[model samples]
Target: MSLAKQLSTLMIAAVLLGLGARVATHSDLPFWGHWEPIKLVAPPISIADDAMAKPDSAFAKSTSAYEVNLAATMVLHMKRNKSNIHFVDAREDTLYKAGHIPGAMNVSFDHIDKDGDKFLALPKDDLIVIYCDGGDCHLSHDLAEFALAQGYGRLAVFTGGWAEWSKETDLIETGSGAK
Candidate 1:
């Protein structure tokens, strides 16, 4: 067959197959399913706005200015300043042993309660930067929130966490786990 004719035939066949599947499945259309519209819900109240919200417990990431992490470079800056700040790693001990941000103490979520006294012992006004593996890891968030509950106010989540720190060759450590 001619080149143009062959190309046209191929295109037609693809379209027919697509139509066939749509009809067979009785679906909304290709690439979209069921034709059903998603239900929209009202946005939830911010934790800060809730009257019953415990001031001591919630990290209130969205509500507080100081609770959020400084940028990674700022964290490095803090490290070099000889400031009395704590770096906490919220990932697993095994991961912490493999590699973590330098000077970051391993404080995994699974053992937070066990390590409660250690954290509680720190001065509430001292700066603490909690981190984990980053990018979908919620350990830091949970731990920071928990710490806030325990009256540790000078909290910040190292938002970039270990993932960002690991990329900086000079900022990572190994075999630092207490285990």
Candidate 2:
């Protein structure tokens, strides 16, 4: 056979082998789950007409967990010092220590056994903003679902999470749970 034919045959065999391996593997490594675009519910237009306060709205009434954009998270963070809004970092303690939203509390979804009390202590009636490592990270989502099941009425997930927050602003807190 010519060199060109040999090369073609090798390429086809490699492709088939790869396909077979992919089919046999149980883990979804190469492709993460379905690619549903993150749809962030718009933040309240202004403090005066705060949609957050009105739980009767369509989005609010439909789901217990609301997906918020970066702007909403930032606004809540700024007022965290004075307001009832609580920012819960769903990432692990190590990642939480590296950098997290200033004033955010680390209650990792992975370490719920250790941090469940801290999470439970927060006022369920108040808005709890949970976030993790952002894109493709399900820690925040899992935590939010757990919170909702535990009777936390008002919950918001900053879909962008730490990745987006760190990139967009310099407002980061580092240390072992000190902010």
Top-lDDT candidate index: 2
Report the C-alpha displacement of residue 37, candidate 1, in angstroms: 28
Best by TM-score: 2
Query: Against the unseen true structure, what C-alpha lDDT does each candidate score?
Result: 0.62, 0.77
Q: Candidate 1's residue-wise lDDT over 111-142, tens digit each?
A: 88786666677677666667788789878878
TM-scores for all predictions: 0.57, 0.67
Per-residue lDDT tens digits for candidate 2, residues 123-158, read 876777899999999999889878876777677888
The lDDT of model 2 is 0.77
- In model 1, which regions exceed 4 Å deviation? 1-77, 177-179
Q: Which ten residues in a row have the lowest lDDT in candidate 2?
A: 54-63
Displacement of the residue 153 alpha carbon in candidate 2, Å: 0.8
TM-score of 1: 0.57
- Residue 143 lDDT (model 2): 90
